[model samples]
Target: MRLELEKRPERSKIMAVVSPIAAVVATLLTGAVIFAAIGIPPLKGLWVFFLEPFSSLWSIEELVVKATPLILIGIGLSIAYRANVWNIGAEGQLTAGALAGSLVPIFANSWQSPLTLVAMLALGVLGGMLWGLIPALLKIKSGANEILVSLMLVYVAQLLLDWLVRGPWRDPHGYNFPKSVSFDGWQTMPTIGDGRLNWGILFALVAAVALAVLLRRTMKGFEIRVLGEAPRAGRFAGFSSDRMVVFAFLVSGGLAGLAGVIELTSTVGQLQPNISPGYGFTAIIVAFLGRLDPIGVIVAALMLAVSYLGGEAAQVALGLSDKAARVFQGVLLFWVLACDTLILYRLRFVPGLPAGETAR
Candidate 1:
């Protein structure tokens, strides 16, 4: 006997909605087992890893801050994926954006005005779009695989940022450190109150609402869905796949870039060797977890943000490794994909049938 997967004739609408919830439950159970294996009480470990993040006002604020970047990046990614354009180089685009946005503060340190902040934000989005455009053009012009090209560019962007920070952009007054001059005055994002929460959260909320409108109430959204679901039909409808590809990449890259600049200005306050905590990569999971819906991504982003806070809290409270958060994220993604697969396909056993052969 052998097991095989058979695609369902029609996907169940109910299962589609339940898939993410099932994945979350499965992840929690698996996390419990992992905690037990590590010699920590499962209940205690789970509390620290999940529930503890919302126990205080400060932690809640940090959660919002963490979720902001995820929401922004996830919204853009949802649009790209909807159009069947896989732009995986968001991390690179984010780095490029941060680098471009930092130019104003690093070189023109004396320039302080509201317009200065506006320029930096604009530059951030432009930088990301430019970085993303490379793969789009290559794919359209030369038929190159976007996945490979975009992923490879991430390392290039990282190396470029590393060189700049370690060499030209290093802070002169500071003792040897891989960082640029600190941003001040209008260079940094303004906070709502005395807490760490900043205006970046508002940007994330606005992006989600805007994209929700774009995807549901516009012709462009119809094109994206049509192209993704049935490219032949989209062609028949006179939608240009090439333009869609460019649009997807530019939109996703720009959001990622915006997130990067906001993170630098609001949280870090300067350019550093490592500015992101893998927000771009994490946002991919966020996009999928939200079922590629912009509004859903907001909630999903907050869920993932808990893991980041939990990771830090676990280290201090439970003596867990800093990498614990990544492990949880990986398990969550695995379960999510698994559940989604089951939603669209059923498992069958074929007795006395050879592998790769269907029962007649």
Candidate 2:
């Protein structure tokens, strides 16, 4: 007997809603097993890894802070993926945005006004769009795979950031560290109340709502969905694939760049060799888990943020490594993809032909 997958006549609507939930449950079970294997009590470890993050107000605030970047980037990615454009270099775009945005504060240290912040945010989005445009142009002109081109650019951006912070952008007064000067006054993001929570969360929420409207209530959204589902049909309907590709990349890259700037101005307060904890990469999983919906991304981003807090909690409470967050994220993505597969295909055992006999 041989096993084969048979495609469904139509996608399963029930499974569409259930897959993410099922993935979460499977990941939890797997986490329990992993904890036990590592000689920790399963239940205790689970609590430390999941529930402990919500046990305090401060931790809850941190969750919002972490989720801010994920939501912004994930919303952008959802647009790109929905349009059938694969952009794997959001991380690079984010780095480029950060560098571009920082030029304002780095060079205009004497300028401390609201205009500085405005310029920084605008340049950040522009930088991301410019970086994203490269892969789109290459795909259009040379038929290059966007996946490979975009992913490779990530390393280039990282290296560039490292060089700048370590060489030119390095703070001269701060003893010799690989970081730019601290942002001050209007160069930094405004905060809410007395907490570390900043206006970035508002940006994330606004982006999510705006994109949700765009995807549900706009003709452009129809074009993206049509092109993604059937390229030939889209072409017949007068849709331009090249334009959609550029639009998708620009939207996603711009958001990622905005995210990078928000992280810098709100959280990091300066340019550095590393401004993100894999938020660009993690947003890919967020986009998938949310079923490529902007509104759904908000909830998905929060769940992933919990994993970040959980990892830190586990490190202090259960004596686990901080790498636990990555493991959790990996397992969650694996299960999510597996569950999504079952929504589109069914597995069956088929009887094999006897001795390779030719039958007509």
Candidate 3:
């Protein structure tokens, strides 16, 4: 027998809506099996992976802290994905932003003003946009594959960050650690309480609302949607592909950059060799899981944040490795893509034909 996948003339909107939910359920079920394989009770492991993060106010606060960057980067990725502009280098752009934003803070640490924080954020955005522009411009002018270009740049950015933190930017008196000097009190982000939660959460929320408005209520938003769906139609309607590409890259890169700076200044408070724990890549899943909507991205980001917390909780509670949590995320992504694929195509089963061409 053979199996085939045939595309549908029209996709089911209901299936589109239900696919993500179904994927989540599938992930939970698969996770249960994985836990049971490791000699742990499936229910208890699931609880630790999904529910334990919400058991306390402190954990909830940590969830917000983790979700902050995810939401910020996810929103930016949604913009790019909506316009069909493949920007797989949000990680690179984020690193670029962190490097640029920390320029003044690290090199000119003596300077302190009310505007120091603002300036760093602005620099970060500029850096991210510039980094984003490279692949966009390459794709526009040279017909290069943006997916490849963007992904390659991620390694370059990571190497650059490693070099800086381990070399010139390394703290002078920090026992030879590969990290920049910590931000001073004035440079730190304001916190809501005595915890690590900072004002960045408010920024992410406002950005989400703003992006929702832009996507739903503006002409640019319409252009992005149309261009993504049908480029010929977009061109016929007087939209410029080049313009959309640039705009998408700029907006996406800018947001990612801002997110990098906020994460650094608010959470880490110093430039380091590894400033991000895959926030850029994780945001891609967030963007897709959230259905490319800003509000949805926020919800998706929270879910992922919970996954991280749950992963740690599982490690402490059941002696599972950190890789177990990453496995859960991978499974979730696999199921999501699988569901999306089935949404657009149906399986066709057939019995096997004769082994030889006897008739011919």
Candidate 4:
């Protein structure tokens, strides 16, 4: 006998919506097992990691602070994904943006001004867009694979930042440290309170709303969606593939660059060797976990931010290695992908007494 089931198209869409939630639950359950294996009380460990971060106003503020960059990058990635463009170089673009934005402050050697702030922000956007354009141009002109080119550029961007901070952009009075000079209050983003939270949260929220509207309520968005789902259909409707690629990459890279600027201005208050901590890469997970929807990305970004706070707490309270937290993050991504696959495919079983005599 063989076991088989008919495929359901509508069921797949419904599962896609629930896959992320299932992944979260699976991660928690799997984590509990790990905690027990590590000689910690599973319940207490889970509570400390997941609940402790929200038990105070301060921690809540920190969550917002960390989530801001993720949201910005996730939103940008959602747009690119919707247009069927893959921009894996957001990390590099982000670094380039921060590097370009910091140029004014590093060279000026004076108090911050409105002009400086605007110029830096604009330059940051330009830096990211230019970096994004490299892959787009290659893909269009030479049939190059953007996924490979974009990802390869990330290392280049990191190296560029390392060289600048360790060389020309290094602070003069910081005793040979590899970091940039600090920004003045005017150059830095204004804080919401005495906490780490800043105006970057508002920027992320606004961008999310704007993208949601643009994608759901505009003809341009329709073109993007069509192009993503069916390139032939889009071409028939007069949409240019090259234009979509450039537009998607520019928007995604520009937003990632803006996120880099915000992180520098609001959180770190200056350029550093590792300002991002992989926020650009994390945003890719955020975009997928949120189902590539604008509103979904916001929620997923917040959830991922909580995971970061949870990691810190686990490190401090549980005496766990910092790398332990990364394991949880990796598990989340793995299970999430697995859930998505299950949603699209199913398992089947067969039983037989013999290969030559297969009759029931």
Candidate 5:
């Protein structure tokens, strides 16, 4: 009898370039299979989900709207991940930022303009930073696991938003709905071409440009790379791990907060229980899919946005359930993880099994 064990493949220099594309293609193929299983034609489903969004103005607008927050959150995550700081609580930070930014609008009910927007954004950044600082502090002082702390905060923030909207911040006028009072003209987000599309798109584009420069052209960026690629080297060079952790989390949290600010002012125009469709969680996928590059995130975000639109199309055209779209998103994420694994490790066969090997 012979025993077999798979060996990891050698690292390929070309895998870096091919991994993301492979992930995308694999996701598409998997989605097609799902469509076939659901009694729908794969070609028609692909056309509706991928092509139809770009064929019309309204659908394209929706794509931009969906992609905006995703890009913003992805940029922050790219920076954090590159610095070796794992922050999984971006969703919580987002919720806190939205709630903090909306306080002025809810209470004042009189002041509104460019200034209000600026204050709201500033508060959002502060709130998110503070939220991120919690785990950072714990990790620094007590050697706590940042991943657990950050992820747990997401549920806390979600509960807080629900409490505020349903109890204290509920709209006092009209009917008893779990929503905040809507902001007037100046308080609302500015649109593109008289449509629901907001200046958040501009903000997203600006952030992408800035992060691209920050990651590629700055001294601080080099430090982050050093910390991530070789932590021991960073320590040998006298870099402070504690400081880096705090800095990375704060910056990431602040960006997520900025995303929340844009989302509230531009889309919902008021506080709601569900501010996002889990953009914060999904941005993690975007960061990895983009290979932790800011410019690549822009493209990845757009692809994800296309999937969102396609899911809607499937719902309407093929009478599929909302869960069907979720399945596609999950498939995309799975394929991305699998492709990244292949990029990092290849499989090989050995002539014979070594000692300690057992086979059926």
Candidate 6:
């Protein structure tokens, strides 16, 4: 018998919550098999991949450091995706934010003040908004596909970053390298403890909480949800679809930009081409894994952060390349899509025609 998917009258709410957990469980099972095939003890390898990272204080701090940007970016993406804006260029927005935020530090290298920090944050948001608006305008005015436009912009941002670091932004006094001069005390982010943890973690948490409130209680939030779920209904209710698209993209881009600046000032302490290790893209997974809720995004971000820490642990212990995060994310994304599909549809077996049967 063959199987076919039949549409469900309504989506399963239980499935919506359970799918992310199921995806993680499935990824662990798959990882175990892959580890065993690679000659590593399945339990030991899995242990290293998942649990070992949490066993140390330093590791926990590192997780927060890694998760900060993910949470920030994911929260923004949650807003955009919920509104059906389809903004796939957060990576580009992030890069643009970093580029704009770094301008003050790069050119005014000697200026040392707290205001520099404030300026960076503002410029970062503005840069991201401008970059994000391009596709929004194109889509609204010319019926262009935002998905393609945003994706292509990623390449542009990356190339622009590469050019700046290797040329103008490069430190003049230091040895030849494609990197900027390290930030001074005023330029660098303040630390919470002895470790590399910064205030950005706190910022992430606050933003998530604020966004959660905005989405759950605000009239704009209601508008966004209505427009996303049923545009026809939203219009009948007097909401403008075009306006929501712009609003969603701007908020998304602004948050992503803020994340970029935070990563620069708080973590990296300088502008570099490799500032983000696909945090923008990985955040897409985080957003879905969180079910597009801000608080949920925080949880999802921490889980993904564990993958980064675990990858490092696996590399150190098993001498394996640290691709744990990427692999886990890919599997998780696939499973999320699968679960979402199944939530809206049920599988039914279809009988095949008997071999003896002949067409008339």
Candidate 3: residue 111 Cα off by (Å) = 2.6
Per-model C-alpha RMSD = 1.9, 2.2, 2.7, 2.8, 2.6, 2.5
> Model 6, 353: alpha-carbon shift in Å?
6.9
lDDT of 6 by residue, 1-360 (tens): 666788989998887877788888887888888888889999999899899878989988999999999998999999999999999899999999988889888888888888878888889999999899998899899989999998999899999999999998898876877898888666767899889889889989999999999999999889989998998999999999888878888988988898998889888888777998899999999999899999999999999988888888888998988676688788878877777776788878879753345353
* Per-residue C-alpha lDDT of model 3 across residues 1-360, encoded as one tens digit per residue: 766778988897887888899999999999999888889999999998899899999999999999999999999999899999999899999999999999978877888886888888889999999999999999899989989998999999999999999999989988999989999755767899998799999989999999999999999999999999999999999999898888888988888888888888998899888888888988999999888999999988999898889989988998888878778878888888888876788778867754454356
Candidate 5 per-residue lDDT over residues 1-360, each given as its tens digit: 343434356656687778888988888888788789878899888888888989988888999999998898898899999999999899998888888888879887789678888888888888888888999999999999999999999999999999999999999993999998987766767787987788888988998999889889997888888999899999898888899999988988988988898899887889989998888998888888888888999999998888778878878988877666667777787877777765667645556666466454
lDDT of 4 at 154: 98
What lDDT is reached at residue 89 by model 4? 87
Using lDDT as the measure, name the better of candidate 1 and candidate 6. 1
Model 4 segments beyond 4 Å from truth? 1-6, 11-13, 342-360
**Which one wins by lDDT: 4 or 6?**
6
List TM-score per model, in order: 0.95, 0.95, 0.92, 0.92, 0.93, 0.94
Order of candidates by lDDT, top first? 1, 2, 3, 6, 4, 5
Per-model lDDT: 0.94, 0.93, 0.89, 0.87, 0.86, 0.88
Root mean square deviation (Cα) for candidate 4: 2.8
- Candidate 2 residue spans exceeding 4 A from truth: 1-6, 346-360
Candidate 2 local distance difference test against the native:
0.93
Return the TM-score for candidate 3, rounded to 2 decimals: 0.92
Question: Taking the tens digit of each residue's C-alpha lDDT, what string does model 2 give over 1-360?
Answer: 776788999998988999999999999999999999999999999999999989998999999999999999999999999989999899999998999999999898989889999999999999899999999999998999999999999999999999999999899987898989999899999998788889999999999999999998999988989999999999999999999999999999999999999999999999888899999999999999999999989999999999999999999998899998999999999999999987898878878854345364
Candidate 4 or 2, higher TM-score = 2
